[model samples]
Target: MTAQSAHLDDELNLKALSFHAQPRPGKIGTLVTKPAATQQDLALAYTPGVAEPVRRIHTDPDLAYAYTNKGNLVAVITDGTAVLGLGNVGPLAGKPVMEGKAVLFKRFADIDCFDIEVQAETPEAFIETVVRIAPTFGGINLEDIAAPHCFEIEQALIDELDIPVFHDDQHGTAIILAAGLLNALELQGKTLEEAQIVILGAGAAGIASARLLLALGAHRDHLLCVDRQGVIHLGRPDLNPYKFGVAVETNKRTLTEAMQGADVFIGLSGPDLVTPEMIASMAPRPIVFALSNPVPEIRPAAALAVRSDLVMATGRSDYPNQVNNVLGFPFIFRGALDVRASRINQAMRIAAVEALRDLAREPVPQAVLDAYGLNALSFGPDYIIPKPFDPRLRERVAGAVAQTAIASGVARLPLSD
Candidate 1:
C-alpha cells in the first residue's frame, strides 16, 4: 500500500476500536420491554404467569408472536467466510459486522436483532445450525457466508422454514442495484431489454443481480457474468451451476472486451480493476454501478472524467448514487415481519425496486438534503437512488413489501379485516 493509504488504515483501526470501546465494548445490546419492578410483576413475568402463556403457545405455536418479541425479532447470522473485503476472517471475527447489521436493523426499522456467529465446518453444518435455532426468531438473515454455499444454505433454509430467510449479501445488493438501475436507465433513455450489460464478480451479489434483472425483463443474451478468469460462457468448464445458468455463448474474452459498446457496466469486484479506457469504450450515456465496497472498481471522478454523459454509482456513502443495501434489507424485513410473511418473495422484491425507483424521481426532502449536507437536490443522474436515511423508505418500502406479501397469500397475519 502507499504511505497515505497505510496511514489511513492505521487511523481507521485506532478510531474504530476507540469508538467501539468507549461507552460499551459493542455496538448493540438488549433492553427490557416489560416492567418487572414489584414482586407481583416478577410473578407475572415468570413462574405461574409465564407457564400459562407457555402452555398456550405449546398448544398453538403461532401464539409466540402474541406473547413475545418474536414478531419483530430477526436473527443476523454469519459463519464469517466472506466478511466485507476481509475474506474468511472466521465467525468470531465477523461478529462486529453482524453487530453493525443489527444496529442498522434497529436504527432504520425498529427491528430487534440477535446477532449469531456460527463456527461450522461446511455448508450442511451451517444450514443445520441455523435451522436448529430457527424457532427463536421471526426471520433469519444469512450474512457474509461464501458463495455456492450461501446459495445452497439460503435455499434450504427458505424451503424448510416458514419465516423469511433472506441472504442480504445477495438480495439486498440486488434489490438496491435494480432500483437504481431502473432510474438510471430511464434517465439515459435506455431500456433493460435493449441494454448490453457486463458484470464483474460472479459471486453471490453478481449472480443474484443477473437473475433479478432477468426477472425484471432484461434479455438473457444482453448480459454477461464475468469472474477473475474471464467471461462465464457456455464452454467454460469452471463455471459454477449458478454461473452456468446465466452464462451466454460469447466471444468476449476479458472485461475490456465485454465493455466494448456495452450500455451498462456493473462491478462487484475488486477496486481499480476498471480504467478510463474501459469506461470510454462503453456506449454513449452508459450506466455504471461500481459497487465494490470500501473502494469501487473505479472512482466516480475517474469514470466521469472518461465520459461525462454517463450516470455512475458506487458502494461508498461519499458518492451520489450509492447502491447501499441498508436502503433495502431493514424496511423489506419490516414489511415481511409486519404481515407475518412466510418468505420474502419475488413480488415483494419487485415492489421494493419500484418503490425506490418512484421515490428517486420525486422531489428530495429537506431532511435528506440536510442529512447529506446538500443545499438542494433533484431527480437526475446524481440522484438515482434514495439515501438510506430518508424517512420515506420505512413507510414506502415496508408498505410495498407487506402489501405484496398479503396479495401473494404468503402472509399469515392478514392485514385486511
Candidate 2:
C-alpha cells in the first residue's frame, strides 16, 4: 500500500544511534518494584521485613514466586560466539544484543529480563554457570551462541534444569519460519509435504527449521540443506551431528542444484549468496524467505525482477512479510512464564505456529494498521506473518503456549486448565 523512500536507511540508522546514545548509553536497566521512598519503606524492602520472605523461600523453594520477581523474570544468556550477523564477536561484545533481547521481553510481553553474557571458554562451563544461577529467574532464554555447541548447551540445560531453557536463535527462528511458511504455502496452494524445499545454511536456524517442518509432515526426501561446502548430503565428510542427522541421501549436491524447480527457499545464510537466476529457476509460484539479517540472500526487488509469481519475505522491516524473531520469542516466553512451564516443548511450539498462522488470516486491527501507516493489510503475499507490535500477539501466542503447556502436562502452576 505504501513505498519506502530511498533515504530511509540513513534516517533509521541515525535515529537508532541517537536513541541508543541518548537513552543513557544502553537499552535497559533494573526497576525497583517495592517502594523505598521512606525509612519505613527501606526497612520493609531490605532489612527485617525482607527476612521473612527470604526465610519462607528458603523453607519452600516455590515461595520464590511470591517473594521475589522470579515468576515474571527471564534471563537472556549468551556466550557471544554468534552475535547476530557479526559472528563470534566474543562475550563482552554481545552485551548490547542481549540487552536488546531484554528490552523486547519487557516491551512486548510485560516480562522482565536480565541479560547475562558469559565469558566461558567451553560449553560445559557455560552450562555450569547457567545452572549455578538457575534459581535467579523463572526461565532462561539462550541467545546468539554458535551452532552445534548451542544445540548441546541447550540440551544440557533443559535436561538439568527444572526451569525452561530455550535457545531463541535455533527454536525461535524455526517457530517463526514454520508459522510463516505454513501461511505462505497455504496462499500459494503448496503443502509442506509436497514442496521441494532448499535451505541455504545448516547452522542453528536451518537445521532446526528443517527438523520442525519434517515434524509437521514435510517430505524428508524433498529437502536439501546447503552450507558453504554445498548441499549437506549423506556421506558428506564435514557434517556435524546436527547436520548429519538431517542430511539424507539426496541427489542435489550444491545450492544451484538444490534450487532447480524447488517449491520453497529458506535462507539463514550470508548476504547476496542467492541470485535472481536462482530464484527464476524455482518452480511456479515459489515461496522465498531470505531471512539473513541486515542483508538477505537475494533482495526482494532483484528476486521479483525475475519472477512475479513468487512470494518473497526478508528479515528487514522495510520489506513485506518480515520473518522476525521478535514475533516469536517474547510472547513465547510470556506464555511459558504464565503457566510456569518446566520446558518449552514441541507441543507449545506447534501451538505457537498454529496461532501465528491463524492470526495472519484474520482482519488486521486499526492500531496495527496505524503502526505501519498502511491503508490495508491482509493474508496475502505481502502479509503472511503478524507484525511485532500487534497487540494480539501477546494474547494469541502467549495464551496458546500456556494452554498447550497445560494440555501437554508441562505446566507447574495452575495458570491454565
TM per model? 0.98, 0.96
By summed lDDT, the worst window of 10 consecutive residues in model 1 runs over 408-417
Ten-residue region with minimum lDDT total, candidate 2: 1-10
Q: How much lDDT does candidate 1 score?
A: 0.94
lDDT of 1 by residue, 5-105 (tens): 89998999999999989887999987988899999998999987899999999999999999999999999999999999999999999999999999999
Question: Tens digit of lDDT per residue, candidate 2, span 269-306?
Answer: 98999999899899999999999988899999999999
Residue 208, candidate 2: Cα error in Å is: 0.9
- Backbone clash total for model 1 is 0
**Distance from true position, residue 53, model 1, in Å?**
0.6
Task: Estimate the TM-score for candidate 2.
Answer: 0.96
By lDDT, who's the top model here? 1
The residue pairs found clashing in candidate 2 are: none
